[model samples]
Target: MTTTLKISPIIGNSQARRAAAASFFGSMLEFYEFFIYATAASLVFGHIMFPEESDVGALLSLATFGVAYIARPLGALIFGHIGDTIGRRATLIISLIMMGTATVLIGFLPTYHQIGIAAPIVLVVLRILQGISAAGESAGSASLTIEQAPEGRRGLFGSSVTSGVAVGFVLASLVFLPIMALPEEDLLAWGWRIPFWLSSIILIVAYFIRRRIEEPEVFAESRRTGHTSKMPIVAVVRDWWRDLLRVTGACLFLAVQALMTVFALGYVPATTTITSSDMLWVWIIANAVSAVLMPVAGMLSDRYGRKPIFITGCISLAVSVFVFFNAVGTGSLLLVGLAGVLTMGVCYSFANGVYPAFFPEMFNVRVRYSGYAISLQLGLIVTGFTPTAAQSLVGVGVGPAWFLPATLGAALALVAAATAWTAKETAHLPLHELGTDRNLRLGKRRIS
Candidate 1:
């Protein structure tokens, strides 16, 4: 369908700031739950939830981590509709609660020894719930923040969402550092639970912030004028399928993130002398730098254009995979740390910072939430399996096969860069004209 959008007066900066803060904190809560589960899977879940040997348990744990990705697209569809029809603020609140609830219950769950096969099954179910919560978290937050942002500064405001992601990784790492130091029995039995339990505190804080948020004036106007699509998913697929595919391909840049953060945590320590503790420090340093620089990347994208920053990130990440793995092979903590900072904190932030603004800007307000969430989550399904897939690629042991996964990540990054190169630059476009008209002539219906 052909869709046209009308511009609305910009809301007050105070409200926009509130929306950004809310989105930032809410994203923080969501990803904090996410990384903690990842950390637990890598460090604890397999032993606790499965009857298999350590290797099998670890694989199962990683598989549970990927299981959530499978449910994310379903979450995107359900929450996307709620976000588009009911309102962004409410959808964000509901999503945060779902994530928090799942994380906390996981903290309290019974082990396989205590409950037989039920433990892993329950864990997988909870992970799926987490996947669903995450489906809405970033997309809703990005859409809310960008829509509220001043015309020239959506990139800057949108950066807050990804900044939260960086901070979440930092928090997850820091929380685990002390826990990781505990005696092995205690570490497995109780220490890992602390981080998940901490979500209760974050949930309360994020809930209050989100409660204060108001809908963006643009979206409010869309509702008043009845400009909303009756079936946003149907509309987005019918009119914007190409954009959806482009977004999915561009999102493969996340393979860089998956290999760098999640897979490396397992791979580097096992094959080399580097300890998991050392890797956690690397992650902390990288993400701390990323949390700071992401906003800078966003501000730069505002001036330079989204495609340049995004494509640059993809290229940098592709190159850095070789450098990072080389550093790992050398067993130099400093080299590895520096490479991690460059690959994740600096390079990946460029794309991560801009995408919140870039993706949603491709769709009119009527289908923006559905389009952004569905496309983003669809790509993430593959990303979620990267660590597991990487492990499988190594066969019996890591050996020189570590490079295999790194090479795979680099290739995906290049593919994302190429896909991004083909997209129209949305940074300087007026909000109402953000999407393309390349497919307009093929539409059978018109949306006004």
Candidate 2:
């Protein structure tokens, strides 16, 4: 007698493609909402939000920039639990709504001059909301994409979310570049609000698309098997603490990226003669290159493995920081743009492309959201302070313009690289085996 084995429903070629496209577009919109604030915080908020602090406005502005990251891990824990317990689709939809609402509110906020201290207070509150929502977005989208991807192509497919982030930065810069280019008198008054207001349209679109996406197959399977954790945080901390530590360490690479992109923009504007328009141009050029390069890096990680690509990216960033800072300090627009393009476009893409696959691959589906979210956000929280810390290190013009921060960035990247080296290689492992102790042992055996 012949017996037929029942097969689970597979996400087909058409569906996978559709899902990836939706994920990519939705992530792009979501990040656009998130990053436009970063851009504005660096360029415009010093004047509008904290106009009183003549000596420390830039530091305060960047501090507010870091404030959002303070809320991120909490957001991650809350949203990650909901995502792992309920569904990735539901979590993502709610995050998009929260981020969009906060961004739109930022556009409408009164200036410090108009409302005194109340303006910055309200801005910080809204920024915290945006941070909370962003903490779950990449993790949720990555979880959805990886679960839907076909075997042997998870690395390639999973990277669409990161690709979306690069696209979002590009879109944010493109939107802000034009506004910054407007006459100086107009820029501070109404032009700065345009990018924040435009976030609404993308938010609405992301909400609709996310609402339509089906729950990931793996998540559904976990629920069916009664394998879902009652408390993902406890499970992750107990069973996957090592992986969480490693991922948290690996995330220092992201600190360098954010520091260069967001903090550096504000830093250069204050210390050097570079105009805000010129700085915006640098962001536009670099992110435009990154938009193309990130996917290529993602594809390459599929072929070469995640570690080599990530390591190369980190080393490149370490070296590039010196040149990037020196170029900015010299006030050469061309060199500044080149530095931005090379660091963000080339070096950062290597890390960005691989992380979506790398971070999720470190955890089991049951605790994947919690492990990835908590660790990554915790690491980011450290880097979020980097802008302020780096500024403090360069105090009162006694230190060299780029030396202190560049050294700090380099040191952080090296530590992350070392942690990554200690991490188990998951490129060849099956999705079901990921995040289990057995896989780590298996990886060690194979290496031996």
Candidate 3:
């Protein structure tokens, strides 16, 4: 007797929720590892990893942050192909493993004092590996959660992943707050390493959870129907390049997040009177509020469409960033803190919250992973260098105060907003209808 294989139903509400939970926790752990490096780079690296001259140390430390971005695109291309051709679940597992290992090794590295010139060189190498891992995390998580989501709720689930990132940032800040309070000697010698070591634990748990999570039904069906792309990257480069450019441009809004955490935090202590703790508190508070509101933004996008919410986010970010810097220039702790909350928490939330839905929806399933991963990571290269560039620019004074970080943030924000405004609204399109002109929804079934 011949037997037919039974296909699974299109992801039901239960599986969609499970995927969102997986995406959330996976993102939380991955970003927890990432932000520790970012936090330490801003607060501790200059002292331990580089030469003792404070200015030189600060510049080199921030430059190391940029180094990771340089590696992200390579990761994106590799994993994007794997996700599109093999499966999102496998791609996600490997990426997490790489990130976790690099982060833990960073915890054990010898300081420059112990290792001479080779310390920073090792540090740079590890940072590049972390970048490669990160390149896949956001895109894979977003695509998985998106494919699993039922119609009309992709934005809501997408926001869960962003909220995971926000929570990770908050957790990273809380872990470091006490460490930063340690005496300079103790902090350099031991306390800072503690946060990185925590990654080993989070990584193991995340890997297991992600490995067990099944590939989304939609992608599985696509493969069964022979609709999977043989060379997704080639297809992306050839057919979807315009959407790729738009996605990359839209992803530039991420620069604001980096500016908020890195440049703005560094700038306050390096030039202004605000304490690092005070700034950390501002970050903690603002990011907390932003996390709470991210789902609201996503649901709104689901209802009103992605472009409107995203464009509004970009414009609000533009105005808020200008105000944030201007407030910093005034030297009042309250004004500075409030400005941070307004820009990072409120204005930028719109930009960050909407992309998980807006970005992935732009491509067909075969190229969706490649399109989202490559475009977003390529845009983030600019964000990675933002701290170094902002610092360098301020050294020469630019047009009152707004001409520095604000000008850069505003210009990027405006460009991203224009990109979103011109793009087609995808929220109303059915999952099967999305990213298709001639391409039809490959595999679909009636859920019984």
RMSD (CA, Å), candidate 1 to true, equals 3.9
Give the Å error, residue 136, model 2. 1.4
Q: List the residue pairs that clash in candidate 1.
A: none
Error of 1 at 76 (Å): 0.6
Candidate 2 lDDT by residue in tens digits, 1-448? 1222222333354556666776787789766875787777777788888866487887788888889889999999999899888878888888878888888989999999999999999999998998898888767888788877776677777778877877787788888888877887788888999998998888877777777678777778888988887788987876678899999999998888667777787788788888766777777677778777777777787778888888888888888888888887788878988988888888877887788888888898888887898998999998788878887777545557678888889888888888888887777788788876743655532210
| Candidate 3 lowest-lDDT run of ten | 439-448
Leading candidate by TM-score: 1
lDDT for model 3 comes to 0.86
| TM-score of structure candidate 2 | 0.92
- Least well predicted 10-residue stretch by lDDT in candidate 2: 1-10
Off by over 4 Å in 3: 1-11, 53-55, 395-398, 438-448
